[model samples]
Target: MNSKDFTAGLAELRGLRDEIKTLRKQLAKLETARDKQITALAAYEKAKAERIAPAAGVSVADVVALAPTLAPPAPPQPQEEPAPTPQAATNAAGRPEPTGVPAPDLRRAPGKPAATGTAPDTTITGGSDAPPAVGTPSSHPGPGRQPTTTPAADGEQPEQVRELPSIPPGQDGDTWFTATPNLTSTRPNFTQQPRQMAFLDATTGVLVHRDTTTRLNLGTGSVADILIAVYATVPATVERIYITAGDPWHRDAERYPFLRDAVAAWLNGPLPDGWKIESTRGRDRLAGHLVHPRNPVGRWQRGDQHTEIRSVGEWFDPDGATPATVRDAFVLLWRALHRHWPDVTLMGSPSQTGRDLWSRTIPTKAGAKWADGYPVMSEEIRGLLHATAGQGRTELITPPKVPDRLPQLIELDRTFAYAKHTWASGVGIPRRITAAAFAALSEKDQINALFAPSHWHIRVTIPHDWNHVGLLPAPAAGDRTWHYPAEPGRTFTTWAGGAEVNLALRNPHTPWKVEILDGLLWEAGSPLREWSTRLKDAWASLRAIAATHGDPKQRTAAHLASRAVRAILLYGIGAFAQRPRITTGTVPTGAEHDIPTGAQIIGTDGHTITWQRDTGFARDPYAHPEWAAGVWSAARAALLSTKMREDNLFVGALHLPPGSVVAFRTDAIYTTTDPAWPYHGHPGDYLKKGHLPGPVTGPRTEDELLSLQTLGRAHLAEEQEHHR
Candidate 1:
């Protein structure tokens, strides 16, 4: 071989080796891209199967059918133009610029088919109108079109979805907003209650508006607001969201009504234009949140100090509370429980504790609890109930009973030190029997006879022209939440929108010249009378449970029983018994107040009433609702109304000195020092039940006593500062 040929061949061989090395480098880059595509695909599949696809399901029962193919429309044909460069696809921050929901990535890998769910390829691809490989980006339409992976169901139109634009500078809320990890990246799904959060979707950096027939109004606020608190902004894309997160803040419902109410409000998504928003109630905005999302469940410190849940090892540490205790609590709040806004599953349900205890129905006395024999309403009257709704138009809530100054309460620094003395357990249940107990019995004999069911019950009315002038002194003008006025026989809060009538307030010595406007009797007239049998049955069940169970279990049973009692008393019976009035006929004693019932009693109240002259099924007020069965349901007319009676009559009677009560809970009083309370809470002091004693109970240990005192002191100081 010639020397020149050898030199040339050697040079060519070296060049070929370099080329081989370069090819290896290219191969490494392609492999890396393939791995990324695989990861992204897995993540997307996980999100879809668990979050997106299931979310797209029509009902909780259809989670499996929604995989791979779902409600979104088929992918549009790929754009003919060359793919955009990396710089063109993203903004200054390097995050992809928004185009449309799940836009296609047109940049393709040189050899491999584009994997499902890979991030958009940013390299340029030559202009090609033809479809790319079956799984590649060239097959999908331009970025402006909606998702293309799934086609819409037959005859169904895929609704266009849009994100909430960032609040404009003019409407921008608190820029310094903070978020707690309550609900993270979750929203409700179809067929599941947005409120129950049963079925959920990821909180798209914005919520997607589904073009579905179901008209659900997702109220204002998003679970992503938690991100705003964490990152000061939502993640740039849905891929960053994970809906399976458990509650980062384990606060329960009743203790955290703000969160509970907020969850309820936010489930409907943002409020539409003209939704009635009481700006003061809580509408003041903080970024995307309506109010300060404070945590209600505080962390327990080294000891038992309750404070914010920021303590170390708080959520992970096992709470020492027994499972039975937790179960009981769950039963009580089963109505408000939620770990799902997206991360979803069934958590709990009511057990047999209640059903078994109250299994036996207590038969009503007098042969017929009401001699009227539970008359059924006609279809016409029932239609009126369906149209007008068996509900009242009036409702009001009692204001806080606290005094502006808590100087005395703060000074005492006693935590539940004073025993709370309420009326006898039977006070709300007690009443003298009537001749209706047995129609054949004489009225005089009925009043003195043993307690029994009755067809006739007293209904008192207050005239339109009445005020607390000479007799009962009303609470301060500014305070409308309270209206007990220390009058006996007034077991419930007086009507906030009308003249209060306590027939017991009538001067027995100077009785009014009453008129029997309706000589006719009402069926089981008084709610108190109507509910007596049910109420007694519940109490009996509670007693039976206590007798059956041992400690802790017995205690929990009693508590559950008490909850039922409260539910019946405040909600069930309270609804039906509202607004019973009697004509405040001429008071010969010349007393200046005429407490009456009906339309006249509501004259010149704070609210303005518009009288509707319409008639027939749509306008009738006397209609009975279908839900109102014998003793199973309360009248719908009263269901929507919420009236807060002072659980302690002492509040209205002015028993405690001004500013002496720190906090008033269910049946306990928190004060800095004792206020000469009726029950000194000595050992063995038990609950007061008139002459008979109740279960002996109080702070079990000195530590408990001290803890209460400390909590009361801190709360008093905090409340005082807030008031200031």
Candidate 2:
């Protein structure tokens, strides 16, 4: 067999082995859980019975009837593994307690006052005939038991009952369980962290730290304790130490004495052969021996398994990211990172969304306070390190379960990734942008474009002259400046035709202008034409997926995200067409702009066009218009307004009063005689207020126009200001 086949077979075998191990452990957990339930229920039956020990002839129906009283409402849990709740857990007396964990419960974290609850349960054994003696310990201690320090049960498999610290109750019993964010993570298994996590792998003894916010490896050890743990053993994978910046030896030395000392030792210690992280001048500082950006200094090496220390902090700038955006951005980034690196460790954070969403409720008795739940790393996370911990499994990964209520956002992320991959370079991750994703791409692109200029940054003018029309429903008087409404006989993009097929909305005072020069830029095979079609197709697929199973809210988010695509495809190219390839603005203030080809703009007077051609003759800059102002603007004008207005790209066309027009906004026509389209009642992108007008697709009399002239004049001023 070939080497490739052998490698593939070997990988499959190893994966199967891990899968078998995971399955066996999970089965063992199920058995333990089932045993705990059986134990609790049996004890409960005996306790509730007043007469002789009630274990005789108890049927299944009676036990089933009692379950609903303590069981938490089951929602659509992703993994189908229902998490054990306090009500379902086997307490010290080994019975399910409704109030909370008892004082003797060992699981409560140190210093936390044990909750006041019912007496510890007695273990029921020998066919539930009688309870165990008072001091006897139950087989299963349930959820709140002191966390087992042993990594695996009997040292055979990983821990089954992971330490998932639940909400510490208030005087009112922590009534805020529903307020939990129900967050989605980029990590598979939908793992979420209640707080940032750091760990020393149970088996490997290798210390690891991960930043959940961005899913990147934060520096392993900066805290003195963490440093001691990292070097406690010269780990197989440890080669270089990466610091956030040069010489962490200044103020940091005092803050992290242990780390500083380690650095000093490594510096003064004899260097290993093939050691790296060189420096000449700053030997006094680790910066001289070590780093910048991510200072990587070799700790040790075993051919091919180089152990290096990585300082991974400076990259995550949380300045602009807020709690809200960070949450949304997490959903977006997680999807991208997960598909790229599935099977990576999942992290958890105490949910921030709960307190914020229910913040105003705090003043009332039922309010949620800011106390975070005790967070424990998810089993998915623990499993990650367990499988490869001491084996130096430092690479990242994620699992496949999606968060509840976040399917739509996840889909948007998937679509965005597909779109990003369309760029010349396939890497679509935004390394620079942080702190939460904005609902609008315009905001994100504007903020993150600093990494490099994108097509979104290009700007050019689309010149045009004002053209008049003969009023509503009547075709404009100029050279085809406006398109009359047509049939909704549109396909793919043109839904219900007419204004719906293109950009033209039924605005009362919105006049149609005709292009004076150049061919249609959005005609078949052209960039704009291809782009709009592609966007329409992409959006159509997304819309179908959303409508079939998604809710209105998802559809709304999908539409908002689509604007970024439109900006890239439609507007991005529009910016390109404004200037031909060879374009030069006037070097001097008064000089004219110059274009080498395609619809060149030429004018002698400075005031009329303000730019002129400076080719050959060294004319005064102030005396000439830009030398290359040519046909590009005219083409741009055609694409931007003239042809585009008639292109039929409406977002749910409104029914306008055919004969007598009123006013209009992007989609809604305002004819109520009070505030019109330009006058907004709210400060958002979309707002609708008008009732449907009569189905009249003809012209009104000049007398009707006369009465509306004043309103028209007022609207015209607002429209200009709004656009400006």
Strongest candidate by TM-score? 1
The sequence of per-residue lDDT tens digits that candidate 1 reaches over residues 1-724 is 8999999999999899778767876875886665454335434533432343233432211222212122233234367756555543443335443322220122221222111001112100111211222221113323332221121112212122111112111112111111211211111122221211111122222221121111122222243233233222222221112121223332233433345333222222222233211211111111111121332121111122111111111111112333234334333333222211122222111111111111112123322222212232333323322322212211111113333333332222111111110000111111211111122223332221111111112222222222211122112223122222222221111111100111121221111111110011112222223223344444445545545667766456455544444343333322222222222111212322432223232111122211111123322122223222211111110111111122221211123343333332222334323434233322112122111011212233445444545555566566657989
Q: How accurate is candidate 2 locally (lDDT)?
A: 0.25
Give lDDT per model, in order.
Answer: 0.25, 0.25
Error of 2 at 575 (Å): 2.3
* Candidate 1 off by > 4 Å: 1-261, 265-324, 328-372, 375-407, 410-500, 503-561, 575-724
Candidate 2: stretches off by over 4 Å: 1-524, 544-559, 577-655, 666-668, 672-724
Model 1 Cα displacement at 214 (Å)? 35
